[model samples]
Target: MLQRKFDEVVKKEFPNAKDAKDTSIHYLGKMQIEHQLDISKVLMATSVCSDDINVPSTTFFNVLFGPFVMGGLGGVPFVGQTGMTAFAHHIPDNGSAFIFYGPHIGITLEGDLGKMYRPRMEETGNSCGALMLALSRLQDNDYTPVINDDDYQQMKLEESLLPYRDEILGSDNQAKAITEATYKIIDKKIHEYIKTCKNEFHVDKVTLLGGVIINTDYGLDDYFDARNFEVIDLKGL
Candidate 1:
């Protein structure tokens, strides 16, 4: 039902996105143009890893929450209601900095909300889809695994593999390793972009949107308050 609703929404709003592979970018580009949002105030990340795409969402939930829940952790709390979790929980209980670590990652620095960023090497392929591909190789004894929306979602929600939860959710797991590595690269980029926003662009507050924010790892409390960033759900706008 959720998938159907998302499809319908995409179909209606993105009629011109016929050849566009990443629907999130298409919709977000449209939204940015429609609302005249300031690109300097927004930073976006996604698994699409395409520099051509603009600040982006439904694909957000699939990538962010699908792994944890399908790994048998169960659905995230309040996710269905607000479509975003706060960034507080992702931090260590005593930690200060918020580190985002999700698979199939992509980072984009948008300077103008009305325009799209050109493809850059640093902004693409910072993801764990390779790991997923490897896992698929082991499972199917095939050399290549085609990573797509349906396969990724099914892999996350597969119940027969529950016994392998340790492998999927372990502290030293491949998923964690991929997320950490990707985060390290993207974190520096984000800080650099944030610095530019503050120093050059004179932008103070950051606005985070997209389905990736819905994961339980994110929280809305003191963490963001300390950083002075705001969460803006596109659904509300």
Candidate 2:
């Protein structure tokens, strides 16, 4: 009953979202059937946020090979092209690659958009702590992110969000809006890196599952709103 209430709140923002575990099963089945991929041989890489909460969000973590983590804060593929090259090189012999990438938002039972209870916590805190921080910083009209080595990832995250500042700030739901914008940015970067490092992959097919991860309260199931699923023919690229 409590879980249902939270689902209502999450679905209000992401109507198409499904349980995270179910999503993993669905995609795994699709990869096996439609894409003809071998479940055991496929290597998995993740480009989601660095948040530990997201680690257990889906079964992909348990079922696949090295999650050659490619994302940093806000789910940006911060590891860049070199990382992509490494991930590609690490694919199982004659096996395909699967990349699961996205940004996550926490939805509370009371209908809040960006806060939830983490494991062992009694209070709701920012799920995408990096993203919420970015949103808070973005609220300041004159604040500009300066690129520096000390906080390069956060700076780059805010820098990537600059163009979407107006769109996100002006939205009816800023949390959801920023999350959506971040998804677009992450998706675009993933493709760019893949295209840039396409040759590094010896595999013939690369399956992609990109989306927004909706985090629920601790011990409850999370959800994934899939936005893109494709099996790229690397041979043609």
Candidate 3:
């Protein structure tokens, strides 16, 4: 009953979202069948948020080689070009590469777009704490993030969203809006990094899967709204 409510609530914001676990099955099957990627040899890398709550979103962790985590907050690939190059180097011998990139937003059973119940928790909290924090700060038009080693990643995450301030704030759902902007940023950067580090990869092709993760309450399956899925031939690049 609780899970059903969550489904309805999440669908209100993302009508096309599918179960996150189902998403993994669909993509993994596509990689093996249509693309001829060897499932045993494929090394997976995730450019999603560092939130612990997101770990259960997909079965990639159980199936893939390495989710060489590239993202920090709001799905920003904090490791940048160097990380991509390193990730390319980590692929299995003669195996292809799979990179998953996206941002996540939480929705409650009662229909709140940015809040959810964590594991064993009684109250709702920000799933993408980094993003929600950025949203709180972004509310102040005069605010600017200060770069420092201690909070560099968080600051950088906030700085990245500045350009989308108006688009996020002006939306009917600020949290969902910010998450969407984050998806665009993450998608752009992932492609750029892949292009810059193409030569580093010995693999013939790289599969890119980018999407938005819809987080729900604990014990309930999350959802994924796939925005892009493409295989890039390194030889052409």
Candidate 4:
């Protein structure tokens, strides 16, 4: 049933596409060069930790070769670049410093959180990294995001009984509360990053990219307001 629903969503979103593989290939080929360069800058910001630390050589490699890899196989090179950039950007140039990159949320530098949160392709449950999990649990399965199998599912028996308050809540008020709470956590983390890392690193702007920006009904604009951040949609480029 989930597969059928997903297929229907894809068909509705890309009606002229021949199949999934074809859609992926065509979509990958549409990535503009200017957009790739903009993404490279965000990848670069992830590396800014201290004065002594220099940009890693791998950063350059990813920026240059990322498109080629994506052409051969569909994946975002910037996602993996986040970790390497954080490692190079640390103040002491030591291995201890870390950062968190939530695909749907945004980047959270070290010190923003008590500990590092590993990036997961799917949100497992109602934990610190469960924004996607809550969205997955929404009762109206038709309102699904453009995510993969493990992350997007029809609500369970209990989840379907959830009461809706408005469009933002869908038919699952619990899911709405969870999703809003998760965004609050992420918003707080970003402010903390601004307080500690922004000036030290000479950071000025933030950019958000991914399927979540387009697929999800939630808007991240207000969360980033007055923070010098902009959301970019490569598909519209």
Top-TM-score structure, candidate number: 2
TM-score of each: 0.26, 0.98, 0.97, 0.29
Model 4 C-alpha lDDT per residue in residues 15-63, reported as the tens digit of each score: 4323323322332233324223233233222211111111121122243
TM-score comparison, 1 vs 2, better candidate: 2
lDDT of 1 by residue, 1-237 (tens): 533343333334223222122533444464457545443333333222221221222333332222211011111111211112222223223212211222232222221111111244332332223333334433443233344666553343232233343454454444433333332333334444334333222222334321221111111100000111233322333
Please identify model 4 stretches exceeding 4 Å from their true place. Answer: 1-4, 7-172, 202-204, 209-237
Better of 3 and 4 by lDDT: 3
| Sliding window of 10 residues with minimal summed lDDT for model 3 | 2-11
**Decreasing lDDT order of the candidates:** 2, 3, 1, 4
lDDT of each: 0.29, 0.93, 0.91, 0.28
Winner of 2 and 4 under TM-score? 2
* Residue-by-residue lDDT tens digits, candidate 2, 152-184: 999999999999999999999999999999999
Best by lDDT: 2
List runs of model 3 lying over 4 Å from the truth: none
Q: Considering lDDT, which of the candidate structures 2 and 3 is the better prediction for this target?
A: 2
lDDT of 3: 0.91
Residue 59, model 3: lDDT of 95
Clashes of 4: 2
lDDT of 3 by residue, 1-237 (tens): 877777788888899899999999999999999988999999999999999988889998899998899998778999999999999999999999999989998888778887888988888999688899999999998899999999999999888899999999999889889899999999999999999998999889999999999998788899999999999999998
Cα displacement (angstroms), candidate 3, residue 27, comes to 0.9
